[model samples]
Target: MSGINWNECSVDFGEASYPYYFGEDCLDRIVASMAGYGADRFLVVTDDNVLQLHGEKLLPALARVAPVDVFSRPAGDGAKSLHNLGACLEQAIAAGASRQSVVVAFGGGVPGNLAGVVASLLFRGVRLVHIPTTTVAAMDSVISLKQAINSTHGKNHIGTYRTPEAVYFDAGLLSTLPSKQLRSGLCEATKNCLAIRPQSIAQMRDRLAAGDLASPQTLLWLLEESLEAKCSVMAQDTYEQRAGLILEYGHTVGHAVEMCDQRLRGSDGLSHGEAVMLGMLAAARISNAMGALDDAAVAVHEELARALGVGTEMPGGLLIEDVMDVVRVDNKRGYLTVSGEEAAMVLLGRLGVPLGSHDLPLTAVPLGIVKEAVATLVPDNQ
Candidate 1:
């Protein structure tokens, strides 16, 4: 660890915190730090694609540190499920996992979340670590404490909060990702600009306009901005049921649309962040119709999405009716008092200003409004 040029930082949750070690081509030192935890075994949770692409960078080093057991599912959003959760848990137990075992989430958000759930449940709570390889996990999901898998009905319905022992990121891994995969996380970064950190909007526009989406400098700025936006909101509400929900600006309709499109096209459809970007566009329209958000702000959403390489339209063959069906069962229903005709959402009255009460930037918008806004993304509303 002496020669390791680690860019050490901390993720502060007020009541809880953990070390986030970031560096270029430093997976070896990162693994050394994880080994310092004095664990007898490592349960590496990852998907097939990540395992194939980047496992060598992590797994061999970990094998030298402790006994490594990997529980891998096929790559894609499909792996985040109750079936995988149950199987991963039961298999870890059968494989001699003990309370002293460390659950290493070794991929993007899908595996990071699956590992989080497994680690939270194993031996009634074991030590957990995150080594995020994807931009979404590194810049967005790992910065927070929320860990979840999708329910049969909607998004993130089955999940809980769990703090990680550490988060290790090597930006070099992101270079191998496809252009589409990279843009997926940029969409979430765009949402942060529109929702929480409005002041950074111009900076982001400048960055996108430069067209250096994969440069080392751009990646560093992306990670820095994400930490600032997510950590600033999470300091007060660790559970994300309050002000932290602002982090979910485009997630409501985004999650619903993502789940629906994934069902139709499997892994080839809209990426999670793309759907969220589209959701932000719809949300902008919804707020405009309600006379809260104006037209120029809505245009900004479109411009950002287009510049980030996201389309403003829905996926081909996806139905407004199916997306609406999932929105009805949106997981935010319990947060506020919404009748069957309404859905709970986070909307803005203007840039940098949320429309709801303090503590919870969430309000009840009629399902009809939600439908109309979403329909604008469809190629043919008729």
Candidate 2:
């Protein structure tokens, strides 16, 4: 927090407001925040893992306010797809969840985004309270109103922007996460920090190099700063019409990596955060080639990866063409200046800044660069 600059890059998206309760016992704060709204019954939508880990705090607190029913699915990002969405809705119905009941997404991004969409769709929109479990969800995905169910076409191919009534982040829960998961979550934070507050990137690298991820206070401070940075930007473009596109800096390549890795197949594979780390590296290279990002910025990212124990390896065995296909098909590209232009051919520039509409030479980015990046990022030293 000390190294983060709040003045120059602060972005206020607009009038949209949602309660974001941070710190410990935030679950209790969630109930208190929603008490005034008067929900008679509550339906908590979560993953099996999170329900086992954190549901106790939320369910009991929610029960204090009203009758609470817990509905959970198997863990993993794949559970957020259409198949699970249907099952979740049916489960909610069986549990007597009604239009009047509040639906709380009680896990990370998958649960939060999925539950928010279900709430929006169920009975033409039920009230939603988002309780983000991971560091990334607390900051980036939880604030965005977009909810989605993936398809064969791509990730989040079917989704909408249905903002939750509130978002509660309890940094206390971050302690239980595995080191890999912690690094994964930190990828989003790193992406945001690199774009807006470059110094934050430096601070995080220093902290991680000093072995701070194991410290709850350090994680919380970093999470808070990251969330504030994103929230400020989200307030400007909740609908992602204009300024919001900056949020997609690393995501374009990130999603492609996830898609190529078949993230839907298994949790043992690359996580959303893991894929993003690879994506960020590739995007950094793109930025470098585009002349927007310099060696210094790229070095900062590389240093952070090593410090945080995040894998900087490029995903090997992945066909660049296949990954590019997913990139073009990504929803964000539709909002870009060259939607009609092939995204496979587009070179994504620096983290914060946009590269103007110029026909990028896709082949110009030698496969060797990606291969070298992959060599650096592979789980095992190449």
Candidate 3:
């Protein structure tokens, strides 16, 4: 893959040119995409934090194309709810946004997911553009059309697969992103690196350790790699049918843990990337118990996660029983139908080599082993 310049590559993930523009000037590319769609009026959805930071820079660029109406919400996990969705919809209507108007999501996963959900539900449907600012958004939430609002039951309980008309990712935005947010995005990129292209994980690990966060060269390369893997998987499983479960390698248990914690607090809490890291650890252990993955491979997976800045350690002193209970209610299965014979958990036999899904015999792995793994993952315990 070396010496072959990615800038010249036809990096189509089975779609016609979903481009990832890098550098400071790349933000304008998002405006150009809206113009291409004949958008005359733009409704921008973001949060207070991003508005204070980059909105000034992005708004003027967008206003040049259409009169831009900005809507802001309190940032963080608390904003991804049915109530906020309603508020945003109210604001959108009050602002005179019509079906012909375009909605631009100008923040991280929360804003992107929130605005995306609004676009899908507004006026039956409206054109939407995603301008993902955070790295985690760049690696996952920013590119997909999946929009969701968390429910008392679980995360993403209410949502749809309404793909945006276009996604504009300016890697230069990474410069403004905080280190933790950058790390969050890297968890997804790390997941892609391991699941789709294990060949480059070592090199990526080195770069991360060296704190090469601002390298335009590295950002450009990593974005292309992650997009290639994720888009290919999405193409084969656009509706998240069976084949798409591959993308949920760590998400099965990840979503459950996230919900369990959020339900206990009655608020949107736990960073998705952090939750997924723990979920990946849990899945790896489950796979190990089922004989799907060996100790060596699991160790390597955990090692890469640590280097990438994901808290692979489970949060709190949660018992295995409580976590498993949440797993039963997870919508990822689409149905509560796990047989006594055991269900297959997706795992990686080796980096870049998807082991596919297989029935994991949980009984095979003693509760003590899982507890030990959990304890070992807790930062305090470590």
Candidate 4:
């Protein structure tokens, strides 16, 4: 009940901290908070779709705080690359950005990440704020300070950690999203229940089955569930290089599948949550093969995927080899040293219980086991 109103929370990331303000249709209030930043100008980092759909409302408000220079990118994960990061910084410089300029991440996770890099690099770090318009960004990405883009080899390959000036969200923006886009957050919520807080599983099932995901109440619940699950892990390990690795639940293989599928289908491919849901399935299978996860726990992953609108089918024509090729150099490698045959992965001994040390939940999953689990999800046509 009290959750529906404007709310503030502290995101204390061990080293850096910021406040997050959120509520339904609270654009005016979010903008009011930005005035305190005292920026000379705001460099709005976003994409074509968000700019077309919601920019008129946000850019005008941001301009009221300071003159706004729009640095828009084409929508999709492709926008988060080293090339775009470099281009965004160059454009911000040409736009007269300075230590007084704030890089506002004004769309989904893609633009949020792009802006994080821009803000961190420009003049060796300036102010950054997040005005997340997508559930994936609000529910998942914005919770951590890890900002990165894809390398030629794998996901999140080139990146840095930069805390934001603050983060803001208006759930109202999510109502305009297509059905396909909703899956990303839903999938992440499922991961939270399965990987971090299994007690929320029943509530999540009811929410999904009710299927009113667009309502403000449901959106609030989704955000809260994500925050409870993630903040539980991230509050201590702000960098997410240690115990917070549990938050990556299915991302290891999920990122690989998502990258390969996006190459084939572009934005129409699996949303990040869908791909990660599939990745959880693979992770569960891998765990079961190792005698860690039970059949019942594995079954829950399947149930949540179906309830959350994720099918087990891998992207058609995406070879296991291609997925493995990406997984081979998965960005999580350096966190723990494993041989060439193993991968650093987050697996579960059971729901809400990661397999490794709670301090460092990541372990070296063998490549063969990883490939076999992923193969089980491949579509028959492929």
Candidate 5:
């Protein structure tokens, strides 16, 4: 933890902008930056596992500047429910939190997203700061303005758009993640490369082959790349409902598989990024079948999946029918006009070229094609 160097970048979404500071072995710098915000109190939102692992290292420093109120839920996607969100709001009020208090999101995507919604709802809106500890949060979720929790019927069904005052992370914290957790963010980054910045595919391949996936250099590279890919598309589209939707390249089907698998396995299911990677595999096949993307391009996705150690096959015990059922209610339904039997999806004509209108990066993909693509991943016995 000796080489502590920090780098700063700005995310400008036309009307608003914020700095994203990141580095290695720099938790102290993150705490110091938060202290400068000069808030009445710091409502640090996180989960049990993160609080146990990295909380002690930064909480004392944060407490030195302002009173700290911690609102924690059991660690997992399940925490992003109405019950937990309401409980967090009540606790913040009960702890004397006010408009001047700042909400600090201090963990992975789940906590970060919940905190974003909490910050937006608390006292109309409080300043929000993100100190993401996981690759998924640091590289993907925290970069955008969307904040949401799952509805009983679908993922991210209940949410709003809220930007953070700033985002900070120490790549050192990611070293503590389990292999599956560590690979999660990179998988999302892979989606960015394939969907937005296909030119970076070679660099991604080199890093994966290098086999030092958790090294600070690799993490930093992924973070920078994600920012570039996402921001380029989101700059003019503040709500991510237009061109920014390209970022959802593999998410339509990926999310359905993820939710279905989560029902069966809970937090033990495929990680979000892993599920999205599989989703991209499905998208690739659908695109190929539709005569948009060629088989060679599809092979590139499979090669990256192998290099990243993520299985391109469907998750075990998952039923294709169940996944199709979820896809029917996909969040991107209205993005394009489709019949009841089709789902709106982002399909690519080639590397870096999405197959859709200039304003929207989605097409209505036939449910039959979607089922066929997903079926390829299922075990024959199923």
Candidate 6:
């Protein structure tokens, strides 16, 4: 821990609060901190790739503190299924895990989500800890209490909100990530800038162009900025049901495009952040048509997308209809009342200002207009 730069932050949920610790090259400190939870066992849920890459460095340190049991699966969104959730539960039970067992999520969003459900359900809820490795997990997923697995019909359909006892991360781990994987989290951070903290846009633009994304300074800045942006909203609306709905900025159409692309290309498809970036483009177009967001704002979205190296257009082999089909069942629907031809979405009136009331940061836009916006993403050949 000598070389590690320890930074501590707290998440206040009104009902509960917990600490989040992060630093570079700090696995030792992380393990030591997790041990202080006073658990009889550690149930580590992770993916095989992470296990192979960082497990030896982390698991051994954890085992020294308490009995550790690993429940690992293949990497990707497919692992977030009811089947795998059950498998993780059975594995924990078979390992003789007790009520004092600490469920430590040891991967990115997928494993973090699955572990969250497992912890919430096991023994009527146990202490949960998140040891996120990926930028997406470190900056986005682990910051909130929403825990869930994807349903066959939609993403995060079967879920609950369970806060972790603590969250920890090491920025050093991100150095090994491929460029696309690194950009995935930055893209989510980009959403935060466009919707929640537009002032950070200048810093983000500078970093994106610097082309040294893997440096500890850049990763730490992204994490801290994301924390400030997301926590500012989530602290008031813990479940992300009211004012926090603004966080869903591009997710409405983005999630739809993401699911459709997954159906077409599996894990090889567009990343969650890339899809969200594309969804922002669609949302910008929709906003412009509604005379809420001007063309200049729309162009800014494209500029950021290009700078982030995410696709500015819709993914190949995907049709506008396919994305629309998924959009019809978007989870944000209940946030507002809309006709059958309208979809609930978060639109921007200007940078950092979402176009809706204080209680609900969403609006109902007609399906025809949604289609018109999505049409911009369609490939010329399609």
Cα lDDT of model 2 overall? 0.67
Q: Mind giving the per-residue lDDT tens digits that candidate 2 earns over 1-382?
A: 2232121122234666666666663445556767876887787888888988877767887788888877687777777788777877887788787778888888788788788878988888889887778776766777677788777667788877775676666676666777777777777777777665555766776777677664656765666677677665566466765555555656666777787676535666676777876777776776676566688768766777677676676455566666666665776544434424445322334434445332221223344454444344444532
lDDT of 3: 0.68
Question: Model 6: per-residue lDDT, tens digit, 183-207?
Answer: 9999999999999999999999999
Question: Backbone clashes per model, in order?
Answer: 0, 7, 5, 0, 0, 0
Q: Compose the digit string of candidate 3's lDDT tens values, residues 150-224.
A: 776666778887766666766666677777777766777777776666777787777788887666666666677
**Global fold similarity of model 4 (TM-score):** 0.97
- Tens digit per residue, CA lDDT, model 4, 247-338: 98899999999999988988778889889999999999999999999999999989888888778889778999999999988888888889
Per-model TM-score on C-alpha atoms: 0.97, 0.83, 0.84, 0.97, 0.97, 0.96
Candidate 1 per-residue lDDT, tens place, 1-382, comes to: 2233579888897797998888788887887788789998999999988999998878898999999999999877788899999999988998899999999999889999999999999988999999988889999999988899988888888888899999998887887888887888898898888888899999998988999788777788888899998888889888888888888888889998999988988878788889999888888899999989999998888888889887889977888889998889987778889898998898988887788865889978999999999888887644
Pairs that collide, model 3: 136-185, 198-352, 313-377, 344-358, 344-359
Provide the clash count, candidate 6: 0
**Alpha-carbon lDDT, every model:** 0.88, 0.67, 0.68, 0.88, 0.89, 0.88
Better of 2 and 6 by lDDT: 6
Which regions in candidate 1 have their CA more than 4 angstroms from the true location?
1-4
Give lDDT: candidate 5, residue 346: 92
Q: Which runs in model 2 stand beyond 4 Å of their true positions?
A: 1-12, 32-36, 262-265, 314-321, 337-341, 344-352, 356-382
Per-residue lDDT for 54 in model 3?
A: 88
Error of 1 at 239 (Å): 0.9
